[model samples]
Target chain A: MFNPTWAMTIEMVIAGVSVIGLFAALGLVLVLMERRVAAWMQIRLGPNRVGPKGMLQSLADTVKLLVKEGMTPDGSDKFLFNLAPYIAMMVAMLLMAPIAFAKDFRLWDMNIGVLYITAISSIMVISILMAGWASNNKYSLMGAMRSGAQIVSYELSAGLSILTIVVLTGSLNITDIINAQADGWWIFKGHIPVLISFVIFIIAVTAETNRAPFDLAEAESELTAGFHTEYSGMKFALFFLAEYINVFIVCAIGATLFLGGWMPFHIGNWEAFNHVMDYIPSSIWFFGKTFFLIFVIMWFRWTFPRLRIDQLLNLEWKYLLPISMFNLLLVTAIAILKWHF
Target chain B: MSGSTIIFYLLAAITLVSAVLAVTTRMIFRAAIYLLFSLIGIAGIYFWLNYEFIAAVQIVVYVGGIVVLIIFSIFLTQQAGEQLPKQKMGRQLFSALAAFCGLALVMLQLAQHEFTGTGNKAVEPTVANIGYQMLGVDDNGYALPFEVVSILLLAALIGCIVIALKSKPEKA
Candidate 1:
């Protein structure tokens, strides 16, 4: 029999390698999905020349980026400039640990899973700040500053919205949260409050990840690629990859929290319907829910105009923050009263 | 040594080295970054002890909130690329003396104290236990101190708003 320590070490190695592979695959697929969605919205064919239906377009881009020289500016802080992208990539990858792709399949099922995610994700802003500051460029500094403020502000609402679900479930463990949805998803069962927090959560996370409408940090016309103005080649690609991965992570968390995670849709006393839903694999359910949310986020990107810096702050502090705070209270009262199904 | 013992030593080394670097680094921005690593190392130590809740809180409050704020202030107030001005000889000597004294005091205290490990009987540092302890009305509960801390935070928030609020410009 294999020693427990050796078995654990092997398991960890496998998990680490698979996560890196998943990052690569996710980066490719998400980039393709974003391009296609954008193209469809914009009345154009996107990257059709790369491969069949342009499925390998991101792969081509990756290859191109890999070969391109990663130039560090003469005046830039060489040490930190190189370190910044890796930090961004590390934060993105570390977020994968607590997420459950399927029932009985996860990395580290620590007790404080949700809290762990929020804590680690808060570190994302530091990477941006480092990149901006290290680049020694005016635009980069401005972009980094804007991102720092934006992320710090939006984090409040995002956290409060997440706490709404945590309040309902009375647990922080991802598995426990999922298992609590066995009867029905919180969005349906918890009713108005859950729906409100879900909306707020989506908006908050969109801003948190520095996505469209809140993509002021990298506003192409305004800041010339923002904090990453100095980065090139694979270094630049790492940031791009990190962005996509962050989007996926946040969407997965959203799916797990607001949607039923891997749980299938079922109504009380609908045994046949429930069994049919159960026949669908849990991983498929998780991915479907996550992708649907991702599509919605991408849709938001295509539809809405980017908010100005002040307007973005206003939307968070004056609107989302207050509303989410109130919603948290409502959810708490509901949870206390056992009003949720 | 066991794997956990090796891990503990590694974390301690990281924490101590990064903390020293944070203070000694001439570049203000590098100091902040080093401080961040030191805080993260401390969080890792907490995780190593299986106090995951405390570790998360450490990362969230220190690395995320405080370090970011420090970096922000540095960005605003200082040229990050510029080296910080060197301290005067007297000031440097005094600071070193102070730090040495503090370290010696701590070491002396550690040598004087007799510590008994709780071993396997120690309470699990789970979130639920932390929550209960924070709010519980029992003798060991921290409900009073928790409320006091919240009140203190509220006071600080109000004070900040008060200080930052702009006065109306007088018409010339």
Candidate 2:
């Protein structure tokens, strides 16, 4: 048997490497999935020539980005220009820690799991702002400012919706939240309030991540390429990769809270059905739920038209925020009355 | 030093150095970035103290909210790429004296206080404990102060809305 200290060191090293690998894999798979989804919606063949059914398209893109020169504009802040992508990547990676992938499998299961995610995710806006400012481009600055306003506003509803779950669970820990849903998922059991919050959560997080219908920050027709307008090569790729990874993280968190996470669907007194669910690996269940959420988000991206910036803010401030706040009160009352099964 | 102690010192160094840079930097945008780093470092210190909830709040409220607002305003009002004008000699000297006096006062307090480290006996800094402490009605609770703060924030929000409301355009 190895010494405990050495074993821990090895474990940490392995975990670090795996996380990096996961980042790369996620970036490749999500990008391909998004393209394929978009293509199907638009009725076109997407990226069929690269490899077998375009399986290696993202890899080829990665290689191209790696070799391309990452140029710093003459007037740009060199230090900050270089630092912004790393910050974006770092925030994305930090968010991965508290997320439980499978039963009892998480990097850091801190007590403030949900809170930590919210807090760290908030910092993502800064990196966008930094990237925009450092690029020294008008379009970049405009994109950054739009993103700043968009994220700050949407964070409220997203946070309130997350709190609905927190109130229902009576705990902020992700593990406890997931475990609480073992009997039945919050979306099904907590009734209308939970359903309302889940819908609000999806919309808010879509805005928060700068996804479609809320992607005023990077409106291609208006702002060129937005905040990363000046970035090219691998530097731009980092921001691109970070965006997908963030979507995955948020979807994972949403799955953990609203869906049963790794917990399989079961009806009360259906012992045989529950036993059959148990046979499927917890990791598969977790990933299955998470991917479904991801696919739904992509569906939103393809189905909806991007909102005007003013309409976007109005949607959050006028509609979603108030609804979510009221939903919180409703959820809190239900929790107190022990109304949920 | 052990790992934790080393980590603490590293965090302290980062906080102090960034704080100094924040105040001393010539570029206003760089100053804001430094301030962001200093705030993050302080959050790191809170994490080192095992006050995870407090640390997260610090990052969320200060690093995320306040700093972003500051940067946004700077973007609107200032030419971020340009260096700020150099301070006049008298103003610099006066500010130096004020800073030195503040430092001395803090040092004096540090020298006088007896820091009895609770070590193993320290209360766990969990979110539940903090929630109860803040909302509890007993003598040790801060419920009254908390309510007052909420009221104060509500008033501030109202004041902002009032100030921001556009007056009816004069009939031309």
In candidate 2, residue A157 scores what lDDT?
Answer: 95
RMSD of each: 1.5, 1.8
DockQ scores of the candidates: 0.68, 0.57
- In terms of DockQ, the best-performing candidate is 1
The sequence of per-residue lDDT tens digits that candidate 2 reaches over residues A245-267 is 99999999999999978888866
Worst 10 residues of 1 chain B by lDDT: B118-127
Residue A236 displacement in candidate 1 (angstroms)? 0.5
TM-score of each: 0.97, 0.97
- Please state the Cα-based DockQ of model 2 relative to the true two-chain complex: 0.57
lDDT of 2 by residue, B1-172 (tens): 4456767899999999999999898988889999999999999999888788999999999988999999999999976467889999999999999999999999999999999867676667778888899999998799999999999999999999999999999999
> lDDT (0-100) at residue B38 of candidate 2?
96
User: Best TM-score goes to which candidate?
Assistant: 1
Model 1 chain A: weakest 10-residue lDDT segment is A1-10
Positional deviation of A101 in candidate 2, in angstroms? 0.5
